[model samples]
Target: MSDTPSPLSRSFTEELWGGIASIFEAILAHPFIRGLTDGTLPEEAFRFYVIQDALYLRDYARALALAAAKAPQEQAIAMFCHHAAGAIEVERQLHESFFRDFGLTEQQVRATPVAPTNLAYTSYLLRVAYAEPFHELVGAVLPCYWIYQEVGTRLATRGSPNPLYRRWIETYGGEEFGRVVREVLQLTDRIAEALTPAQRAAAARHFVTTSRYEWMFWEMGWRMERWPV
Candidate 1:
């Protein structure tokens, strides 16, 4: 009898997501997300979130590129590149609209420093992208796509009275976004199929850690967090 560990007895997507349920619950329970979903989130708080998201996307685009460079398959390379560019372009368009509404100048947006949680989250993804195995890095990047898609879908279904909040929800929870999430999940599952039990465990750690960061990111925005110094 061959002992190859039976391909995890489940998909890595299920395992990783199952392992993070409490964290995901915490994220879903976070007031920031709730308020945004219901159209009650403070405008300033949402503004802070959008600005930080814009900054986060800049580095996130690079991280995705790094993942693309490390991809073992031609398909993965194309997928990552497409998502990377799409991520950047979507954020640029969203930010442009928000900037016009908020009277934010390009200079001002450029001058804004990355929030602590944003830096930590994006930096962790970058480090993983650069330093980990191709499959592991792919695991690392999955949550960013997965979590936002989840959040977007939930909020979108609830239907916000606030146009701004609804717009944010639509971008994430829309059919187009769902398609992107499905593509990433499929790719992650393909990569996970080859990982050993130990490797799967490691990948789970990355997933959970990043999931926590998603929680922290919303909390950071809610608090309008700044450097203590």
Candidate 2:
């Protein structure tokens, strides 16, 4: 047998990730993700996802800034602040490129109502950032960083014929983004070392909950989710 430990037998961060294996599998199986891999996704669905994502990033940046404020260490604070800036940069650059390609103007994207799942996901993160302990906030946000990296890395192997989708995969699958995710994972493990059993459980709960949201976000995009009256 290999020397590598199974996910369930691993330490904090790995254990947390392993516990949500089912959800991650579902996310990979999601139509939205599969379409990205095959480059068959409809333009309308992709447009809606990009718009919702741009809106989502603005609030996500805020939540990151809030996490920075709550961080106890200088390094942690700096990391969160940098991530916050990075999130905004992604919105401005990646999303903007997509917007232009889709013939969407900034005004139209801004005026577009936030999709229901998009709003709910961001609201959950912001609520955790404002109200939860720092460790829990980290748990809440980690899925976005970790899962995207996983998805990107996986899709990059298959590659899409569509240039735009290929660009999206490359962004997350690049070494720099992988390094960013690794840093956060390391930080999560370090934070876990100091947590009480109860605290660890709480953090795990948030991780699992946000993970479900991650899957839902894709499902929403697949459905081109809208707010119904």
Q: lDDT score of model 2?
A: 0.91
lDDT of each: 0.88, 0.91
lDDT of 2 by residue, 1-229 (tens): 9998775567798888888999999999998999998989887888888888889999999999999999999999999999999999954799999998999999999999998999899999999999999999999999999999999999999999889888899998889999999999999999888999899999999999999999999888889988889
Candidate of highest TM-score: 2
Model 1: CA > 4 A from native: 1-8
Name the lDDT value of residue 219 in candidate 2. 88
Relative to the true structure, candidate 2 reaches a TM of: 0.96
- Positional deviation of 227 in candidate 2, in angstroms? 1.0
Model 1 earns a TM-score of 0.94
In model 2, the runs with Cα more than 4 Å from the true position are 1-9
Q: Which pairs of residues have clashing backbones in candidate 2?
A: none
Candidates in order: C-alpha RMSD to true structure? 3.5, 1.8
